[model samples]
Target: MIETAAREQRSAEPVVRPVRPRKLGKVPFVELADGRLQGVVSSGSDLARVYVSSISAATHGFSCSTNNNRPCGGLSGGSPCKHLRALADEAVLQYGLDRVTRYLRVEAGDDDDLMSRLDGTREAAPAAGVFSRFLRHLAYLELPGSTAPIAEMHWFPAVSAEVR
Candidate 1:
């Protein structure tokens, strides 16, 4: 579910820019992690499949592959595929435009969107590490909610609410 609370004013809290959450139907997991905007994105053609996608900050080096490590067929065109686009769109929804563009080190030109400004080259990166972390997050969701904190949750980064 998207955070409706993100719409409320936080004027008293001293926040210069407030976050705006969005409901991501295709992107179940997204994070500004590992110096990139990375997450698990559902396949458009198959319900049982997903792609691990990431766009590196500044350099915007990109990668998209199946959990088993097969490269996406869409990458040969020298442009970002649908999966990578969805990942960026959802990243903006989750992190807000200002924060995401800043993290990606992208400077706006005209009214162009985030994807258009990205200058990236496909780099084959390992899918296992990101997939592994997403799995851990899903596992935590299976636990019963309790007031008492779990010891391991302490190690979770406080940077974003999606992880918690």
Candidate 2:
């Protein structure tokens, strides 16, 4: 009877183990045109755009708002978030700025005026407005959904205990 009771008690006890959060993987490097290793870049002129895109892609997804301020999980509310850093790092590794600039010039097309508008070297123009809207749409596609609503819908941080 005593042995049976002890066994039952031991079986009822819960086991506990340490838990660790998963780590984000490192970004890969791309080769550049200058015989120097760098990350992938569409063009030198597009470097700023690319940097913004990558960072926004990495951190803008599923953000929460508290007190009217948005906080991104991957970035923790930092400007020029990790995604931007990774993109820049990759770009430096893949191509020097010179190559990137040439690429941008080639890609910008006959609309030299549009390029200048984006570069902010000229007065605000109608084309700039259209381009801005297009970029906003792209950003929307990259980061979808409101994290605040999701958080309000769920209860998190489950309780755990250990028995010895």
Candidate 3:
């Protein structure tokens, strides 16, 4: 049994770590297409918008209406709520954090190029409202509802025992 275990461990396949269970809002929208790689997490009542900034991949932004005092997530929170960690974890798991940051930077560059290309055809005067144009172009993602609220779930750490 010891020899078999050693052989398996030596195999070329990348080691797979068990994923930790998330204890925050449900994520229904994760957009990586526009290069921002944004996610919207909702808990039926409140919503949190988390995104990789176009300015910097290493930089992360999160906004939640409930966070009127201080940001509840990892970025700004003193305690670092699970919701913040969960969104970041989801992005990192899909694309390593480094790669995601680089990708966002590249995408931001592409956006600039596109804007410059359309400069001639673009409006000479600003829109009715300052951010009206920007808001019109923004994409809104909605989260699905669960039969039972996530807050009610019982969570515990995993454990294993070996007999001698």
Indicate which candidate wins on TM-score: 1
Error of 1 at 137 (Å): 1.4
lDDT digits (tens) for residues 1-164 of candidate 3: 45434535653322333333444336433435432444544444444433221111233323322212233334343332444345445655555444554655433332233212211211111112212322333533245556875652323223322112
lDDT of 2 at 104: 38
Among all windows of ten consecutive residues in candidate 2, which has the lowest summed lDDT?
55-64
The local distance difference test score of each candidate is: 0.81, 0.32, 0.36
List all candidate RMSDs to the true structure: 8.0, 20.5, 15.3
What digit string (tens of lDDT, one per residue) describes model 1 on residues 35-129?
Answer: 88899999988998999998888589899999888998888787899999999888877777777888889986436678888888998776888
The residue-by-residue lDDT of candidate 2 on 47-87, one tens digit each, is: 33321122111112211111112232344543334443454
lDDT of 1: 0.81
2 or 3, which is superior by lDDT?
3
| Local error of candidate 1 at residue 82 (angstroms) | 0.7
Which of candidates 1 and 3 is the stronger one according to TM-score?
Answer: 1
Clashes of 2: 13
